[model samples]
Target: MDHEKVNILLVDDQPAKLLAYEVILKDLGENLVIASSGREALEVLLKTEIAVILVDVCMPELDGFELAAMIREHPRFQKTAMIFISAIQVSDIDRLRGYEMGAVDYVPVPVVPEVLRAKIKVFAELYRKTRELERLNQELEDRVRARTAELENSTAKLRESEQRRSMAIAAGKMGSWDWDWITGDWMWDEGQYRILGVSPESFEVNPANVQALLHPDDVDQLRKAIAEFNSGTRSYETEFRIVRPDGEVRWCVGTAAATVDHSSRVVRVSGVTVDITERKRAEEQQNLLAREVDHRAKNALALAQSIVRLTRADEVKAYVNAVEGRINALARVHTILSLSSWQGAELSKLIDEELAPYSPSGQIRLAGPEVQLLPTTAQTLALALHELFTNSAKYGALSTRSGRLMIGWQVDDELLTLTWEETGGPLVRTPKSRGFGTRSLLASVESQLGGQAKFDWRAEGLLCRLEVPLTRKPAATAPSKFDAAAAAELQRASG
Candidate 1:
């Protein structure tokens, strides 16, 4: 609705006619431009934003129709309003032609100043209104684009927020629920369904169905917690077991707050449930480990006491050495079991520890497959091996640099058979009387460990064979001919 004066171009073949048209439009308060020919009018239009172009119908080469056709061909001027001014009266056909060529109206020659000014005024006003409508449309389009962009940005932010919320819920292993206690209506989130090991499509959601998933023993606990809430408790927490569809039981911890009526009747409950199965399992394992540690401690102390009571020595130094040596053997086995989390100790490692102090490298050769012995078996075997190693160092193969001792073991039919052979040592002879080392070794292998031990005092050196059950059970203690043949084969293999 701008009231600013718009440009009006007046074209004629004669300068006088152009001036006349200009004089007619001058009173309309518009900026009137004069062009003496059609070409001159096009030149004016190229340089100016003409609201109305008044062209001479008959001109030298490019007339009104030609100029209008050329102007309409240009994209910028396609909608421009044009009017044709003619000196002679034109035919209806010529007028139709002028209208088709983009002319808005026609002005006759020898025009009435009033008529010419009125026509120019109407067309110029129309041009101004059309420009205003185009400007308004452009502004509306800009606003729509800006609003669309803002809405897209807001939608993107909402989607991102939802993704982060879902991730947080999953990471915490938690799910939320809302229950209408009055109507028995319930709503569970995705996490709730997942924790219960059911899907919305597969499971009916109701109080009875949900209760069916609970462990029978824990159902009373859950009901008691709810009863407490109904009796004016603001909130309650409970842990229970869930029997999943796959027959696996899982632990869940839930905390809920209830809204009650004026009479303290429960109206609604809302809460979150978390999967605590792994945490509960870790706690159970820790308790079992504690109990096992206590048992092992008591047994080790009792065994140490027995060793101190049974150990005998004529001299105080010898008694101290014997007791210390036996206790040291127990301590070494204890350390190995502790390192393995009280599971077992490696057989090869246990033998190495017992003989490392007495046997030099290459003089003592140990040949055995890797074997893991139970804690009790490891402790017993460590004591027996310590006794044998001590006796050998004092009087047998380990006492001389040229002596060689070979220890080997094999597992067959769940029984471990080990052999110890000595060579290149002083001549051997049977003991006149049994020493504490020999007696302790025999008792440890035969009675406490439920195994058998055989000693052969050969002319060259002592050869010993021990048989123990891997199951930690007592095996037959009677000697067999197969044992004699195995011992002879071992001696031949050593030579």
Candidate 2:
């Protein structure tokens, strides 16, 4: 707690001699530690900060020279001054040995208090100055660390700005150019060189050089836009085409702003160009798809109208039901084709939908490859399958608990051959007269699908075989959906 007191340690084996040393150093006005032996002195040194230590030459264990050597070995005591006292006459060799052991001076038994006080005062002052120097050095180091952190933060912010600018240019597919209108000098970034398919060394800096690569049709419009920009009438915004060095044509949209002098005269122009060829192509495709959808919708409506006309019933309800079923069949096929982007419909899927009412039944079995049918064939076949399923559910294989049906198909070149057989049901025979459903089924296969169908009546059941063309092209036919057989069949059914 006493900041002004410097610790001075005195070591002696005799209590009387320790008393004598203490009385002499009492006038120094410092904290004094007295140890009876060398061992006691080391214990005091561990707990206290000593400016100086005085030791006696004669002791029982660990005499003055040995204690001084131990103290000098400690890094904390590197600056501690030691003094040795002896009652006997000392030789030159003994004094040299004592000094080598870190003793500052050797005093005889007749001690002088003034000389000892002066030596202790010098070392005490040195310790105070050393502590102050350490405090100043620490303060300087703290300031340097704070300044370095500030510089690092500033550098990080600059790097972040550069990264964001680079990302913006890359994400927008944009290239920048700056031109001095008066000097006809232009500077472009690497992105600009890539956009034009030309290296910087091969590119001319003049505006006319750029105009030469403009598409023939877009040259006039681009020139007018540039003229307006130069006159300060309008800010530059235009879509044009450019032919690159590799002879590839690309669509480009550009925006520019003029840097004017104090007099409002345009001196420099800077702008960005973005490649828009993919966007333009996508728009064109979208428009074409829209027009195609419109045309297909119109044709579908016309076809439905013709189907309704061709479809006849005994009364209003029957007519509505028949038309509704037929249209639903057509719609199902349309859905299948639409899902595949009008590529085709899968044969297995078409059959599964028509036979959904009889699903999970052991009586019906369908097997075939995943053959794809053209849209027209799929539509015609969907209607035909609907009628066949209806007839079987009413009077054929699907009508009895034990009835069984099997349908399978195989592809041969451009023809898909399908077989339908019924078993475990009442014997089927040729009908007395063909019904509307039967006639429609036949007409759909033979005319609409450009296919052939034959029905055989046997004692076991009825067997139907069909061969359909797998061509993607639609079957050519007149607009009329009515045929002589369908008309006759409708008349008979109505009666």
Candidate 3:
């Protein structure tokens, strides 16, 4: 809004262009300084705290490119970016020369007012923001110094006050422990003894004492968090468990942050602790409660969906008909697996089941991870797998016998992934609209199984990838999905 603003520098040899820019930017409230010649611009910058510079390349005595090179020679102005504005069409070679001369960008003559305003506005706003941030950072550093000085002046007095008056308070609140970071010696205030239900006279305060009282299961996590603190890796917030001599276990949470010296070595760390036994108990039961809620909600959804399918059996509306179509589609998946007595059905069996019903020739084939699934899981995978097979048969690579199909499965850790590939088919393109079949496939396989389904339609062929969790209990050719023996059999197979 004022001539003394620091965010922008506007330069143009033509009086008309400079006047036009001033008019356009008048209401912008951004810094604006005009230069009729490159020499005039360089003279203005000798004293101004110029955040940016715009130089016209077609000036009379010295062009924008020459002026930029001169500015680059000055260390103070090395990063003061220059934008070249000129009427003459700049070639690649000319642009390269401009860049070499420290020109940050080039804008042609007869620039659109809106585009110019937007561009300049962005650079001006960024310059002002950068100035504001630098001021804030300086203020923050000053405040931190003042605070640190106060802490240094009062540490001894504060320590004495805590030792005299805080023994009982800490015992009721949390155990008090302090460590000499340099010497690795530790001291536990009398409150520590009460927190652990130990007699102070019988206990020797050391890091080992702290470890001995912690529950074995929580030791590793606490140790890691503390390790990060010691190494100055990050601020410390750690949770642990303590079991007293009376065999009563309680949860505890500790926080610590290291203060570093000038050379960056940690000089000291201090923080507080809180007894969190009740909080930990709630956390332990959270998963069970969540699962119960999810099970009930899912059962309700399935019932509603099933009812809708039955109720809309005779409806002709496209969307209502979609519900009925999904039910029949799921039934088809069941039919294929049922044919095999629910034993691990062949991948080819699934492909043929879905595509054979639509295409004249069942040119389906299978490859990779020749394995069977639990019957329940089978219906889910088969339905999704079938959708891909059907899509290929009609609108994908599987439409022609010349098109090939590749199907495979793999298991690693507890994850099972299936891949489907089709080659020698039609060109790949995105779908215009997703159909009921797509919805059913996604719902049956991914939504129900808590897994992911990915589709990649490459020019070469269509690729489908499905990943699900597999049990470690071994792979089985067992009869029913719900049978424990079946899970055991699969575990054995996996091994």
Candidate 4:
């Protein structure tokens, strides 16, 4: 206990009594308030809490007896213990009066200061203990609240887990099983009975009954996978067909892993079986797509080759490299399309990625608003733009070291326009080829983009123009569409 913090009140009319009490309690290191009258003591009590009060019984106006009586009357001062102080001896009636006024002890004056100080010490220690108990109770309450919060979080997680289990069993068409070796008990998650087309009450889970539903042709592999499971030789994995009594055969992927006993023998197994008929159909479709894409890519290369052969000048390796480079650019676009399962490519992302080689230090400038096109629109535009860029590099404005290329686009109410202009090369000239690049570039862009094109061979440069319709039909807003942040980052990097 901090004795310095305890307050002692001395209510006496005599100045000498007040001084003596202060001197004794000063050595006890407690705060002391001396009240010269009963009224002063009541004022002191209202502002501060005193652990103990020493009252002088004999006084002129409102004496110690009256003060003690008033202290006992108020609920605010009920816990204060009063020890009566007096010089005169009291009669039986006065002693009875002191008891009625809440006096526990009396000290005859001149007061023994040590006795008074010792009595004050007892009450101060009790105050300290009471405060400690309150603090402990508050801490216990906080801990209980924290524990309750943790339990609520755990319960919510358990409910979410049960919900997830129920949803997967409902949606995934899976069957589950569990076995206990020691107790010889079997349990199945709800999905297990559903996939087997059996009710929970109807499922007889013995090994032989479970095997009855398997197709006859798959018996050997099923037996092998199960044998490995029972002997602990390997993890279980097998694909088998199940023929229902109605002659419907469904494919399933069965897998299990063993739990071992103390002797290192296989004691139990737990696993799931999933119906894979739909997945198998999807795989077949994927194989067909792969073959189709391969055929298309080869045909594109062959067509480019025919264009190069028909347009070639004798013994010029530069022309050959040019032909192959154009084909390779188209192939790169095809590769990106394949990653999307040939669904489509984003028009803007396709342009930026394909034009990167020509922009070396990103000296070429490009910016536009935005546009979206179907997969066919994307391929046609990619091939057409590739042809225009190749020609500019070889014979038009971009042929010289200081040449600059600027590409831009805009959209108005009913029209979209794209322009490609080059500067600082040798003066432009007409292309000699009526071959694939020239003919294909014109036809594809005009017909496919719902656009027209014009080529100008100027003295200083070459310029090409495009106009496409803006009233495009709505498309599904696939979330896999190009992320704008990533596109802007690429622009900043290239710029």
Candidate number of the best lDDT = 1
Tens-digit per-residue lDDT, 54-109, candidate 3: 77888778877788889899998897767788788999999999999998787887
Off by over 4 Å in 3: 1-7, 156-495
- Which residue pairs overlap in candidate 2's backbone? none
User: Could you tell me the TM-score of candidate 2?
Assistant: 0.60
Q: lDDT tens digits, residues 272-310, model 4?
A: 888888988899999998887766665455545444543
* Model 2 poorest 10 in a row by lDDT: 474-483
Error of 4 at 80 (Å): 1.9
Residue 112 lDDT in model 4?
77
lDDT of 1 by residue, 1-495 (tens): 348889988877888877777777777888988888777777888899998888888888888899999999989899888878888889999999999999988878778899878888888889888889989999999999999999999999999988876875776468999999888889998899998989999898997898899988898977887778767888989888999989899999999999888987889999999888899999999999898777788778766866786677999999999999999999999999999988889999999889877747799998989888888888878988888888888899888898899999999887889898998888899976667677667766776667789999997989999998888642212223223333343344345
Task: Determine the C-alpha RMSD for candidate 4 after optimal superposition of all C-alphas.
Answer: 13.2
TM-score of each: 0.58, 0.60, 0.31, 0.47
- CA lDDT for candidate 4: 0.72
Which of 1 and 2 is the better model by TM-score?
A: 2
Error of 4 at 18 (Å): 1.8
What ordering of candidates by lDDT runs from best to worst? Answer: 1, 2, 4, 3
Best by TM-score: 2
Q: After superposition, how far is residue 449 of candidate 3 from its true place, in Å?
A: 99
Per model, state how many residue pairs clash: 0, 0, 8, 1
Q: Residue 191 lDDT in model 3?
A: 59
Q: What is the lDDT of residue 131 in candidate 1?
A: 83
